[model samples]
Target chain A: MAHDAAAGAQPDPSSGGWSREVDLPSERGASRLVMEELLEQLGHHGWEPTDIFGIHLAVEEAIVNAIVHGNKLDPAKTVRVSCAVTPQMARIEITDAGVGFDPAAVPDCTRDERLEVPSGRGVMLMRSFMTTIAYNARGNSVLLEKQRAPHAG
Target chain B: MTAHRRIDTSKVGEVTVVRFIDKKILDEASIQELGAELFGLVEQLNRKSILLNFADVEFLSSAALGKLITLDRKVKTAKGRLKMSNIRPEILEVFQITKLNKVFDIRGDEAEAIAAFQ
Candidate 1:
């Protein structure tokens, strides 16, 4: 579509979808620009509002984790992000240029004692909002996917 | 009283009612500023009964949630109470998913939340 091209999203001939790639600085709020474009593409593809909200939240949490936790907000580091969106689904991959950490090591924030803790809930929220989230062996990169829910009669 | 850029505050009886200025509370800077302003209400002004009205907030991240948790802790430590109301369904789902619904007293509306305060 005209809008997709204007946003630098090229046709994904394989799936009749569109895709985009971006490299973001390891800085707070940098993800906003990327999310703005991606969200527009999701809307253009006719995604439901609820699904879009979940996808937006999941991707945002992932990007924040990459910048804050993985890259530690080092100016020297950059987060590489790629995304593909179709009428049926959306997929994203984010990679950070810093030492990665173990996802499993993150504590369960929902536990009784940990309920009041201020941090460590980002990873859990990402997992809950995204349909599937997979991390690389080094945990420096993550892939998030969400499928469009069928329309109600 | 510290001037607030991220929140608007008013008093309903003895309760300090706070509403967010931002519709989407996600960015780091805003979250940080929000945390400071909210903590100031209890730590500096010593306003005991606090109600965070989420009527304007459509979206918030875990970082925002962190600020709320810390504010709750501060209120409890000061022997004050904290409650939230007017959260949209999607945002409410976030609390339910994280089980934070159990951590904070969430009311159906601002009037209900303020009335529950003692």
Candidate 2:
């Protein structure tokens, strides 16, 4: 499914920085479509395929963590996704209503003992793919940024 | 060739090849469901060795990777080996970042992966 960024998107200044909010129910598969649409938006903004895939894949992990781990798949709790797509960079912020945790406490998936654990890799991925990943003091909100190469966004 | 739900499967000698039809696997429920499907197939078919071909898959999320780990663990418990093949570099980066490359036996081609079981 192709999501046209210019179709219903608001115009912004060339310098970058226009964002839209996506409220998703705490469902297991809800993150897929949102990430797909976000990728399409970034592509429209001149992001290259490799750049798009890199960021898109990371964002997918973030949204899934927010929905599954943070919200615990509760229907009442909502995962809020904030997106900013620009030619120079893309910034996505995801926040959940559930209580947050210490990011430092996550076990290393690379370790043999923790290799089979299911929840350890998402944050690692976000931190790896995004040039910068900032979390709120409460740890419930995460801001992920990826700078596009000079050739494209 | 046999189609098993969303995943397509085929037999090459004694090895079973499971190919994912979707390019991207980011859906959490779908990933969980995939784990179940793989486990059921392994048990039903009594297949000890398997090859997971990712040639058509372009992207994957952590949840999907976790499911793969789960599937691998089950195969190990059954005294079988699960090998992955044709992982794209971009997708492989995720495995490298998570350091899951150590946990998975990733091969360059399906033939190599299939031959490993024997």
Per-residue alpha-carbon lDDT of candidate 2 for residues B11-108, written as tens digits (9 for 90 to 100): 89888898986777766566766777788767777788889999989888777887888888889899988999999989888888777898899999
TM accuracy, model 1: 0.95
Query: Relative to the true interface, what fraction of contacts does candidate 2 keep?
Result: 0.82
Question: In order of the candidates, what TM-score does chain B achieve?
Answer: 0.98, 0.91
Q: Kindly report the interface RMSD of candidate 2, rounded to 1 decimal.
A: 1.5
Best by lDDT: 1
Q: How well is candidate 2 docked (DockQ)?
A: 0.73
Cα miss at A71, model 2 (Å)?
2.2
Q: After superposing candidate 1, which stretches have Cα over 4 Å from the reference?
A: A1-7
Highest TM-score: give the candidate number.
1
Scanning candidate 1 chain A in windows of ten residues, the lowest lDDT window is A1-10
lDDT of 1 by residue, B1-118 (tens): 5789999999999999999999999999999999999999999999999999999998999999999999999999999999999999999999998899999999999999988985
Residue-level lDDT of model 1, residues A1-153, one tens digit each, is 112223565788988787888888888998986899899989999998888889889999999999998899888778888999999989999999878889999999999999989998888888988888999999899999997777888
